[model samples]
Target: MTLLLLLDDPAQPGVVELQSLTDDGLPEGSVSVAADDLASAVREREADRPRWVWDDTSRRYPPLLAAGVRVERCHDLRLCHAILRRSVYSQSSTLAGAPPGPWDGPREPPPVEGSLFDDVGPSVVADPLAELREQLAAVAGADEPGRLRLLLAAESTGALIAAEMQRDGMPWSVETHDALLVSLLGERPRSGRPPKLEALADEVRAALGQPSLNLDSQPDLLRGLRAAGCDVESTRTWEIKALEHPVRDPLLAYKKLSRLLSANGWAWMEAWVHDGRFRPDYVPGGVVTGRWATSGGGALQLPASIRAAVRADPGWKLVVADAAQLEPRVLAAMSGDTAMAAAGRKADLYQGVVDAGIVETRSEAKYAMLGAIYGATTGPSAVLMPRLTRAYPHAVALVEAGARAGERGDVVSTWLGRTSPRPDAAWQAEHAAASAEGAGADDVRAARRRGRDWGRFTRNFIVQGTAAEWALCWMASLRRRLLELDGRPHLVFFLHDEVMVHAPAEVADEVAVAMRSSAVEAGRLLFGATPVEFALNVAVVDSYDQAK
Candidate 1:
């Protein structure tokens, strides 16, 4: 079933306009509901499991959730429109050829309830029925319509999940957070730096023999280090650690502490966490490769130092599952490399690589595999590349082909047809200059370097992008399974390849099974009949830190 939903008109106050469409998108009928009865209407229609087509999932779903109404599926028009606009598979579609308008902008930050229809531009009032027909036609007319349809479905489901996770929020313990902060960084001060950070700063200045040095100023600190005989180009942590100096340890400590203070400190808690929950504003499909990014609250980059503050409710446990070697396994399956797939059949893919005699140690295997996918051309990775290529020729060839295509300024698509963006006009001009009849040596070398850099980006894009697609499938499957379980298990947090489900202690085991089975289901969905295994390390714990 398909339902077209329009935002309620401001003049109409509580009335919502809706139309039902047949499978082929012909309108069957139209209906209107008052704001007070909107949830009931949606709930009644959910019995048929309709795929509600709306302007934006993030904007529309939250109000439904607030009213305790959860739909089974949806088609997020705005998100799908963005995908079809740039996807190579849909280049011939009318949507792709149309001029930019309301649909081309970044998703507006979710609006507050009651004013949901407020501040919306032309997109809210524009004919969504016409927009829906255009999007459906775009997908149906694509070179590989099935793959593009799957990508759109998965991406839209992700938008719903993002909103639900935000509404449910992560279970946070502010008391524990404060205590951890105090233990690492001294008691909160009225104004200045905490005692521990201040002490570390003093130690750094003393070790450099420059008492008046302003450590926060990069130029001043670099000058001080050079004056004290430490020849380093930058104040990066790795560069400082490589230097042999007494100031190294204190400076590193100071930086770590400073990051904690500024990034996740007491001020952060006050702003983001409220009433025992930390809700982050997640931007779905924010990354070019389809990885999620947080618009606020730094959810994607939650530091290990503060994870201890994430605690479950009294009777619930946190079921945390991280996909093991996700990208490598994805590459193996997508490339159909029998050797690589066989190597990943076990829990430890790197060890499997070592047992195959492809590398000397597990570390070398990791470096070689990552190097192959990411186009590493120097260091241990470069040294180990030949052996890997000899062992898994197909996997190596897949990414190598992508790199070659990128060097020629061509775009590449993922397994499910999400295409990489082409190099911009500036890059094209530079390459053109180098190829001119009288091009200089420097210009030629510069263009070659630029090409190699872009090549590296494309080399990883196919694998990383497909890996992201696999993750979306995994999460979508797990979401449905979680709903079937007896306990009210809900997803609380999600990283790139990790998910944490909060469930009753008895159902934690069920959640673990769901997580594992979802990986299998996701694999079948992406690469049917492939031998590669997507394994996960599942842990049931009371707190987030204990999951490891």
Candidate 2:
């Protein structure tokens, strides 16, 4: 009744049969052990049975026994079967020097066993219930929570979702709304001359208090108007006027135009909300810097039409707040540029840099300072680099150090654990070769490129990642407070710098308090009790634009 087993290496195609044992006489219980441990167990069993004789010539053996000579029914039947099967196969393969046959390789291991009895012996295991309970407790006790908020104008939810899906690499299509007011209006070409859509424009412009209303000069100006009241035609007119404004900068202008043409575009977006609640598609990992993405509707790119559509639920008011020059302020704090930090603390950092005699003009200061931090070498950076080096020597040096580190192929981490991936060896080698060439036209160009790339990486890794962390904390706090409040106001939207909550008209003040508290808590969590502050504007309206 001796049985033989064969085993093989899949990669090598080599087989081995290493041992033999009896079938019914094999170890008796259901317990199993790894094949490697079989030899030790057999030897241990033999130590207790010194008088028992084993025949080397025949491939058969007697039953195993412990030292007491009591027939040890303690034999693990499954373990013995597997071990013998593997050993026989391994030995057979070694003898054959070929791949194992169909019945050759090691058999799958037996299922694990456990017992209900607690005091059965040392073999009994403890239940995982206690461990699970501890895990639940830890989860409850952890103060930090991670979640995302997406604030989109009720009308732009579709575009936001589409954009978010695009960012997430998800395939999606935009829905066309033929009956939407924008489509109907846009389809009819304004008479031989463009209509005095300026009145509608004037109303919206006056509402937002923006001076630029020359439709020829400000195309897409309608995108800026808020939908304060529910006059649908007026809302459509405001959006169209904004969209029609001529953009002086071609690139910026194109973006404005594209936003209008995309299906579920700015115009159609005005109709997709349920009771004025626009739920934009939120792609959590949309931005490379951990910012959220909106899909179908340009949720992130709030058009005037959509903004006008954001209305406070009856009895509630919309409270809007935004970080002033958030990135620059963050950069100042992170780089420990005391001067820069002080400037940010007082007024706009860019303007402060200009006043400090860093550059001759505001534009120069902005470009050079931003370029210095962001590794901008072309266009704006090219014009501003020298000014930045002269004005803020220490700030320039800090970013330069980061750039140097990046050029050497080091991965940089933010103040938090978030890290940037290391540059490939190819990039490093190219940079080194460029550096070795020494200041020729090509060499200078290469050097600038390398420096700029590195600076850009370092700049964003710190500012953007930290900003994302701050945002996550803020959202978490707001969520918690919302849960605590009695009136169940729903969080309808979250944009990078803003949040929109839909609440009853009566609880508008309460919601505003909650929003402000969340921002303050977020600031404290990230920067400690610093003097960082935010300004908010609140309004009640039937449309998004009216709230502003």
Candidate 3:
């Protein structure tokens, strides 16, 4: 008997038919169709041509759609044939996706819930803009145009905060900002020197209606001044004194602290800015595998007091973007473990793995899996290994093999050129000697020696070093793309895995698009035909912490 299946227009959507033919060459199921069913039927009665017909018992039918349409009998046969064809002809699936198109609108970050600024008391919130305007007016009233020291001071503080935020992944919360202000102005002794400082103090004290004050106790004074506006508290115990001050009223003290901190931050920033502008230096080839490095001035650090000065240049704004969960995604693609890859494609890879029955819980799966790949042994891995071994035997086996090789003191290399160096001769000798011992106490020695012989260290070097290369390429690509934009925004800061550019405000959106495009490009450049992808977060702000 022969079986035949017919499908609708291969080029368009339609129906399917199945047929079976008896050994005697008679159609056994349904009506029999001629070899050229569509052509013959059309010739006899053009309008009555049947789209599909079949004999289920004999399993024979006329061709539907085109002859090139796929044909098979049993389900297994079809699947096997499809797999073979794909394996032979399809390109490797590790390539990155296409670059993003030009941005059409603003790419502002969504408002963060529970920002650092939330800690600031209600006084500033009552009318922050009004308070700022009033303070600006008072300082402007005392000084001539261009010589407005208070404005300069505020600008400087903003710059410092921006720098610090870039360096550390810290939050720019209100409490931290207040603490930074206190730290900056806490202990400047009143030297009656720097005439501008003394003059500024007098003006501020007058504004707050207080007696001449000692600036050394600036934190206490700042508290009192904020209290006058109905917001005051000693958030930092180290800055407070139990004894009442005899020199200045609390309001004057607070005013002095706020002014001094703002002013001092400005002065420090002025010194840090080389030549004329506060252009921070960036290190492109910083990490071992291609990540960034930090040079002089800790350009990445943005202490809160200094962030206010990081205002967008007049008519320009800052736009920032960062990747989300990049490393695990890379791992999922590299291993080609279908189960792991499927889990990753759905959502957070680590969390997905836990839900997919890979481990008892999310934390256990993450710790064990990450530990296995990253060579984390003593801590979380100890608790995580058994579950991982049970769930992902193939993926875990690869890592275990690498770990064993590392113990044996062998070198391992990634697809790229980076390599983990081989172990020293002393370690090799111990393994060799242990191999010669017989079973007993000597057996323990042999086991320990064999453990060391496996390439545990080398395995990690291969994975981490390669991962670093990917990060480097990602940063490099982003830097190049940013440079290509119309305006020549300076590439001011880089930490391993992140790049910070200072560009004009109008082109901020363009810069963000460039960043996204560059990440995709970098992935393609490194992985070639392998399937790879990326996600990014963008923000516009005066400081790095706010960028998050």
The prediction achieving the highest lDDT against the true structure is: 1
Better of 1 and 3 by TM-score: 1
TM-scores of the candidates are: 0.97, 0.50, 0.47
Model 1 ranges with Cα > 4 A deviation: 8-14, 113-125
Query: Where is model 2 more than 4 Å wrong at Cα?
Result: 1-259, 266-276, 347-369, 378-395, 424-451, 529-543, 546-548
Report lDDT per candidate.
Answer: 0.89, 0.44, 0.45
Q: Give the per-residue lDDT digits (tens) of candidate 2, residues 280-352.
A: 4454435545566654455577655435445554465555545556666656555666676665654466676
Find the candidate with the highest TM-score and give its number.
Answer: 1
C-alpha displacement of 362 in model 1, angstroms? 0.3
Tens digit per residue, CA lDDT, model 3, 136-195? 343334323222231222222222222333322222234333345445454344453344
> lDDT score of model 1?
0.89
TM-score of 2: 0.50
lDDT of 2 at 71: 15
Worst 10 residues of 2 by lDDT: 56-65
